[model samples]
Target: MTTTLEQTAMPEAEADQVRAVLEYYWAKEWTDGLPVVPVTEGYLAEFLAEVDRDPDEVLFSITHLNRHLTVRLAAINAAMAGCRPEYFPVVVAAWEAIAKEPHPARGIWQSTTGTAPFLVVNGPIRGEIGLNSQGNIFGSGFRANATIGRAIRLALINVFGLHPHKLDQATQGTPAKYSACIAENEEQSPWAPLHTEYGFEPTDSVVTAYVIRSVMHIEARHTMDPEQLALDFVDTIRRTGSLIHEYTSALLVLVPEHAEVFAAAGWSKEDLRDFVFEHATRPRSELVAVGKDALSHKTRWRLSSDHPDSMPDTAAASDDPDTVRVLSHRSSIQIMVAGANNAGVSAVVEVFTLNPPREFPFSYSRIERAGH
Candidate 1:
């Protein structure tokens, strides 16, 4: 639902009080209102042993804060999110991914664009953690999916002090700020998991987080001409101009049902990317149909003032399509074959951009499940 800001500064307290302290830090406004498991010293110690990072070491530094999230804080939030003791490692890794300096945390943490970051779990760990990658993957009811995502948000608030309407100035916050997570249907996926695409191995577990401004559904029957279906899909997005966001481009998550329509014809994720990049593009003139003054410059983005006339209307909005690239950067379009038992159509996970991706101490990582 809605997460408000946590209570004002809490002074130092005894060891036993830490749990109550975090809960208070979480409850007054830090949380999405779900009950949280307390993060105790013992829990933090256990996570540290696994990750083996210096407690004071800067695992990540937020550009928006004077504070840096310690391994202890990440662990505490992970614990609060009901992560298994072993899951702390994964939590830490996800933090590293989002905290990457260029990952775009600063501007996104406080943007009027009203977007929220979503964590996607890929690789073999999906089944180990019991994530729902197959049916209703994006829906609620999965422990790992829910908690891992929430753990990061908690870290953002408790660690970086980004609360609603204060530093995080969104007119209408999204559900992802509460909990947004999902796993890849690796068993059913035809291509390499996203982690592998980003450099991790198939055997390795990885977490990837991106700012998704909004999500939309792609409704189409399994047509004989999948390319034709794709054209319609592009047209669908073009009409709304969501792809032409003043801030960034939109994300399109393709489900298995829809993927197979292309697969039957042997169309790979790359094929989809190529097809989309080739056919789903708009001219600069067309992209700025709403005009250029729509977007504001973000500090997190490494943009050049070189193009004063890329589009008649884009001078002030944005110039670097690379930062906001949608269909081109194989990294931009994450294709996950998931959703529902029976379906001719699939839901697209359109993760709207935050800025450029942040690169800091942390990167996508996963926990080693107990006994695994």
Candidate 2:
């Protein structure tokens, strides 16, 4: 059996009456504290037609709240977020990524730390839909980038009831919470596109979603030496507050300038990830100084209780703070290219750091084409 929302059409109101509709919805607290396009029956139907999917098909379920997300409701929220009908597929893919098992973003939406699911689009759809992967890629300007991300946020708010101060209790919410989506600059990338790296063909579209706690921007123009550049990035990771202490996902968005340096010197994406993972370290004493007890830190990394391997022989004997690995594993570091091809600038989108990662692990969903 299919589930469909009852046809709720707005009354025939002239342009002047638009304000009343907006005000009524706002007063009802149905918005994200922002103006939204009214989702009438006609508009919702138009969006659903683009996907040709069963409107009642359950995409994912918020079991705690007894809420099952359906395509029709997604279309309604997409329309309210001002998305074109064609954008619905990408929205569905993003939501599916977040709902994937072992990485479901159940608690992330309401965490005390301000975290938001940032979407990264790959493949032909990015160019087909005019998703920005160039200059100002992470900034505002592109309609597809803004509204597509906003559509997901709208679904969380209107459909799943993730309202602020209630389901979403972020203490100091970030501006990125509104919409943080961008496409990878595959054309400018020195290596393969993200989808290709994930084993998808070049033509297949893909979307990845992760709950980013914060971002760290890096500028590597001071020196062209590869070792020096890697040191700069490794130090940044070492100093940054990682949500998880070990073997977790961290995204590095390398710009053309930084990527070119590695490409010219014969360094692949794996090379970069490995180098950073090896160098991103601190002494066990450093963790102790930060109030992370040595015993817990060892357990966090799964080190042997009797023979901890994180600390160097000298550091362990002397209680020095210069011999522990900060980043957990090499495979957890993901690399992508974006931004203008000019300066040595980059950004790191960090994931949450739970000792025992319960929710919000890195997730990816392939974007399905209509009629495929």
Local distance difference test scores for all models: 0.63, 0.76
Worst 10-residue lDDT window, candidate 2 = 305-314
Best TM-score goes to which candidate? Answer: 2
Error of 1 at 185 (Å): 0.2
Where does model 1 exceed 4 Å of error?
1-30, 101-105, 243-250, 283-289, 292-331, 354-372
Residue-level lDDT of model 2, residues 254-337, one tens digit each, is 898888888889999988988988877676656556543233344354332244444222224445545766554575677899
Tens-digit per-residue lDDT, 87-178, candidate 1: 67677777777766354545666777676767777776677668787776667888888888888888777767677767778888777778
